[model samples]
Target: MRSALALGPGAEFDRIRSILGRLGERAAGVGGDCALIPAGDGQLAVSVDLSVEGTHFRTEWLSLEEIGWRAAAGALSDLAAAGAEAVGILASIGVPRGAPASAVTTLMDGVGAAAASVGGVVLGGDLAAAPTWLVDVTVIGRVEVPVTRGGARPGDGVWVSGRLGAARAALDALVRGATPDPEAREAFAKPRPRLGLGRALSRLGVTAMIDLSDGLGGDAGHLAAASACAIEIDLGLVPIGPGVVEEAARRSDPPAVYAAAGGEDYELLFTLPEAASLERVRAVATATGVPVTRIGRVGEGGGVHLRLDGREQEIHGFDHFA
Candidate 1:
């Protein structure tokens, strides 16, 4: 298996950011300080993500459209973490020599569609040869309503934009040699994040939010630890994707486990004042055509706990280091 760094979205970009000071333009750097550009008195929020063939997804399981959609959506997802309105993208693709031309076209189409879905587009890209297919995207976005992890308060209600564990379920089924049901397969192949909802949450008075690409358990931990608040999720209320229940039964894995530890769900984990009206948030989601649900709340201390039908489950999520 490839290590995280070799796979996708694993490189520690900060070290490289500081190192780039030694080099000049061209490496003029992920917009190098263009993100520093003024934004009509709003804060600039930038994020980038990469995806690789074997590590991120295997070609055997995903269709051409699925890979393309995931490539762009993954990067946009990071932007969502910051509650930013994405404007556009810069893409770089590393394709192995002798790869078919049709494959490239298909993947690029996916990128275009995904970006368009988010009200963003790819300005351009750099293509090169590598041993595997690699897609990297640098997303430029703006935050009119900053929703970082630092703002969670004790009484904040915890919520997610959509279902959990779908993508993970899709990928795990492939890994275990079990055929995924149509819904499970779709979750992994073409995961969709709640786009307008992230920014809408900001307008609706959200304090902190993150998309559930990394799994609810660890992602919640991120919001809690960063906000210095405690987080406890009610497993019973977790919104699950279609076909997850029957799929888990077929695979002999705990359905709840899939909901908690599963990666690539692309749902949002956000905090709002407990007293704030969810009517507007729901209305906006309905207007913008996405589904969202409040699942938990932040507390006084910084820690993570999971209570399921009154039984506690161990915390779970992606652990790149482990």
Candidate 2:
């Protein structure tokens, strides 16, 4: 058996699914964005996300409030991806020794603000002491009919909400000790979850849905693997966020490379039937105040393919262990 250190995030999740398969019907949502639990007359979607001090953020790179908001938004993004309406958030924090009590209060303030921004609240959680600061957020939401990642079928159109790569550019700029553009900085410090868009798509015949937390390349692969279908994305059609081209040029990398593989975007990636017209998608995008772009299509086969100027290119997404 391959050790966890040798497996990518996708493989690790697959292993988890295999283990959860022992539960049979009880594990219905184990492999998707949020675990679905039957509630009275509806299903409750729940998801948890962790932000470690070193792995997810650095103190010098972001304010305490930004850190808190980013963590909360990321956790809630899962609920959105599940096509659920936000209900509440549970936050757990680990404070290192000597950290001020005011710091905790300020962090919670940010968390509360983010939850409230989506008509949700910070319900309750536990606290602990740790060697480094950490935040773990659990989000609970309701969905009359939950969407799962495996529902995508052949002949579906792959679409994405919002442009890509600003957060990636900002990360690169921060790492290099250079100033990033205002748009890029905002994208990195405060990512907006497409809750309204997800809700709209859920009712608009969307077959499968996912949040682009792991970048387009990796997230697309996850959706493809789940649906047992192939996805071909046209690099030319992907909407690149402002400042990405310049940032890519600085590093001598193609803009498509970053747009395709950059992580922490938090945009929605979904599939709709081929019969759905672009005008319908545009209307949804307009109503949700987000831009929707069709970048690809679903086909028979497996894995995700990226085509740039009609030529195939290979790129990968962020892997924590890799």
Clashing pairs in 2: none
Mark the regions of model 1 whose C-alpha exceeds 4 Å error after superposition: 1-37, 250-254
Q: Which ten residues in a row have the lowest lDDT in candidate 2?
A: 1-10
Q: What does candidate 2's lDDT look like per residue over 52-153, in tens digits?
A: 999988888988888889999999999888889999999999998999999888888878888988889989987899998899999999999987677789
lDDT of model 1 at residue 308? 81
lDDT of 1 by residue, 214-235 (tens): 6888777667766778887887
Candidate number of the best TM-score: 2
lDDT of 2 at 299: 90
Model 1 scores worst on lDDT over the 10 consecutive residues at: 1-10
